[model samples]
Target: MKAKLTDAFVKNITPPASGRLDIVDETTPGLVLRVMASGVKSWSIRYRPKGRKQLRESYGTYPSTSLSDARARAKALTAAASVGRDLVSEEAAAAAAKAEEEAKAKTIADVVADYIKAHVAKTRKAGVTEKLFANHIVPVLGKKTVGELRRADVVELLDSLKNKGWRTNAQVNRVHAALKACLNWAVEREYLDANPAAVVKKQVTERPRDRVLSDGELKAIWEATDVRTDPSRAFIRLLILTGARRDEIRCMTWSEIDLEKGIWTLPKARNKGHRDHVVPLSNEVKAILEALPRLGECVITTDGKIPYAGQKSLKESLDKAVGASNWEHWTLHDFRRTVTTGMSALGVREEHRERALNHAVGGIGNKVYDRHAYLDEKRAALQAWADRVMLIVDTSGPQNVVAFEAS
Candidate 1:
C-alpha cells in the first residue's frame, strides 16, 4: 500500500490478519512502515548503494520514533547511500568503536582489581593492600573512571577519613600512601595518565612512636591475657617475649617452627626486611607453642584453619580489663618498642637488641661481612627479656635472669 506517512495514519493503522503489511511513504522514497500481525509498528529504509543489492535498515519503532524524525532519518540514509556510503557497514563500525572505547575506560575499581592480580599479589603487602582498598578506598572512589580521577577526589577521601575519626591523621597518611602507590602503578601500566594522589600531602605530621610500656603496664597487660583464649593469649605473650612483628606472630605456621632447635623461621616474603629471619624461641615462647594444640598449619589460629584476626576487639577487651589510665594509648606494635627498650635497660648490646628484633644492624659492610645469624646473642637477649617479663608477671617464682655481654 502507498500513502503519505502521518502520525494519525501510523497510530490508527491496523495489523494484518496473517503475515505482515507494508505501507510505502510517498513523502520519502524507500521509507516503509511495517505493521506486524502482532501489532508492532516499525520504520525501515530500503535502498541499493550503487551496484550493490537492495538493503533494508530499520531505524526506530513508531510512537517512540516520531513520523517526522523517521522521514528525516530515511532521507539521510538514502542520501548517504547515493554518495556511495555503506550505511550498514558504517553503523557496525561505529558500534564497534563505542565498545572499544568502553573497554578502555576502566573504573577505579577495575584498575584496582587488575593492580592486585598483576602486581600486588606477588608482594607481601597483598593481603593488607586488598583490605585497605576494600574497606576504605573502594567504597568511596571505586565507581569513578580512571580518567575522571582528580586531586580533589583524593583530598576529599583523606579529609573524610580524618573527619570521621575512623582513623587517626597518622593512619590517614598510610591510606594516602597506599592510594598513591596504587595510582602510581596504574599510571605505569597506562591505565591512568597521572596519579591524582601524588600531590596529596600527608594530613598530619606523624611523630616516631616513643611510647614504651612500663613494668607495671606490661604486667597488667600480661595478666589481662590470662582471661583471653588460646590464640590471643599466646599471640600477645609471643609479641612481648620475642619482640617480633604483630603479623609475624599472628600468621605463624607450624611449619615455620622447629621445637627441637627452639627456632621460629620467618620467610623473606613475610618480614619487613625481606630476609629470612630466625627468631630464637626463648623457653617461655617454646612453652607457649607446646601448650597450643596442633590445630592446623597456622599456629596462631582459633578455628584450626586461618590465623586469628580478632586482635582489635581483643585489644579493646584487654584495655577494659587492665583498667589502667596509663595504658590508654598503647598499641600492639608498642610491645615491640617496649621489648627493645627493656633490653636496653637490661644492659643488652645495641647490635643484639637490633638482631633480636630482626632489624638490620650497621651499614652495607656489616650486611655483607657479618653473615653470622647472631643466634647466640639474639637468644641471650630474648632470654633476658623473657625472664624480665616473667618476673614482672609472676613475683612468686624465682626468676632466672640471663647475663648479657656488654656492647
Candidate 2:
C-alpha cells in the first residue's frame, strides 16, 4: 500500500486480520510505515549504500516518532547512503566503543572486591581487611572509578573521619595504611596506574603505647570481673591470667587446650606472628576454664558456634564497674604489657617473659638453631605472674610474689 502519510492516517490505521501492512510514504522515497497484525506501528527506511547490498532499518515507533520527524530522519539516512555512508554501521561501531569503555571503567569497590578475592582472602588477615573496606573505604569512595580517584578525595575522607571524631590520628593512619595497601595491589594488577594514597602522608605521629597497668589498677579490674560468670568476665580473667592477646583468649577452643598438660596450643593461622605458639596456662587460668560450662567449641563463647566478640562494650562495662575516673584510659592489651612489666619488676628473666608472651626472642641464629619450645620457662613466668595477680586482687592471699630465676 502507498499513500501520503499523515498523523491522522497513522493514528487511525486499523490492523489487517492476517499478515502485515506496509504503507510507503509518497512524500519521501524509501521511507516506510510498517503496521503489524498486533496493531503496532513503526517507521523504517530502505536504502542501498553505493555498491553494498540493500538494507532496511527501523528508525522509531509511532506515534511516539512523529510523522514529520520520521520523514526527516529517513531522508537524512537515504541521503547519507547515496553518498556511500552506512549510518547503521557507524551507529553500531560507536555503540561497541561505548560498551568497551564501560567495561574498562571499574569502580574502586570492584577492584577492592577483586583484590580481596585474589590476595587478602588467602591470608589470615582476611576478616579484618574485608571489614575495613566494608566499614570505611567502600562507604566513602566505592562508587568512584580508579581513574576518578584523586589524592584530594583520600585527604577529604581522612579529614572527615578526624573532623567527626570517628577515628583518632593513629587510627586514621591505620585506615590510610590499609587503603594504601589495597590501592597498591590494584596498581600491581594494572587496575590502577598508581596508588592515589601513596603521596598521602600519615595524618598523625603514632607513638607506641606505653600504658602498662599498675598493680592497683590491675587489682580493680580483676575485682570488677568477679561479679559475673559470662563470657566477657571469663575472657577478661583469662587475658589477665595468661597475658595472651585478646583474640588468642577469645578464640580458644576446647580441642586446643590440654587441661592435663596445662597448655593452650594456638595454631599458626590464628596468631598474629603466623607461628604456632604454646601458651602455658597458670593454675588461675585453669580454674577459670574449668568453672565455665561446656556450652560450645569455643572456650569464651555463649554459644559454641562462634567466638566471643564486642571487646569495646566489655571494656566500658568493666570501667563502669571499677568506678575509677582517676585512672588512665587503658586497653585489653594493657593486661599483656602489665604481666610482662610485672614479671620484670619481680626479676623474671627477659627471655622467660618474652617466651610467656609468645614473642620471638633473640636473633635469627637463635630462632633457627634453638628449636627448644621453652615450655618450662614460660610456665614459670606465667605461674609467678598469676601468683602476684592473685595476691594483688586478694590481700588476704599469700604476700610473697614468686619469682622466676634466669636460665
Q: Per-residue error at 182 for model 1, in Å?
A: 1.3
lDDT, candidate 1, 1-407, per-residue tens: 99998889999998999899999999899999999999999988898787677889898888898899888888877887897787778989999777655644889899889888988889876888898899999999999988788999999999988998763578788789888998898888667667889988788898898989988999989999888888889999999998899999999999999999999999998999898999999999999999999998999997779999998898888888888554458889999999999999888999889988989887988888878889998898999999999999999967788666666
Please give the distance, in angstroms, between residue 247's alpha carbon in candidate 2 and its true position after superposition.
0.9
Task: Give the residue spans of candidate 1 off by over 4 A.
Answer: 1-104, 324-328
* Per-candidate TM-score against the hidden true structure: 0.74, 0.73
Q: Pick by TM-score: which candidate is best?
A: 1
Off by over 4 Å in 2: 1-104, 405-407
User: What is candidate 2's CA lDDT for residue 325?
Assistant: 67
Encode model 2's per-residue lDDT on 147-210: one tens digit a residue: 7999999999988777867534677887788899989987876666778899999888888889
Report lDDT (Cα) of residue 27, candidate 2: 92
lDDT of 2 at 142: 96
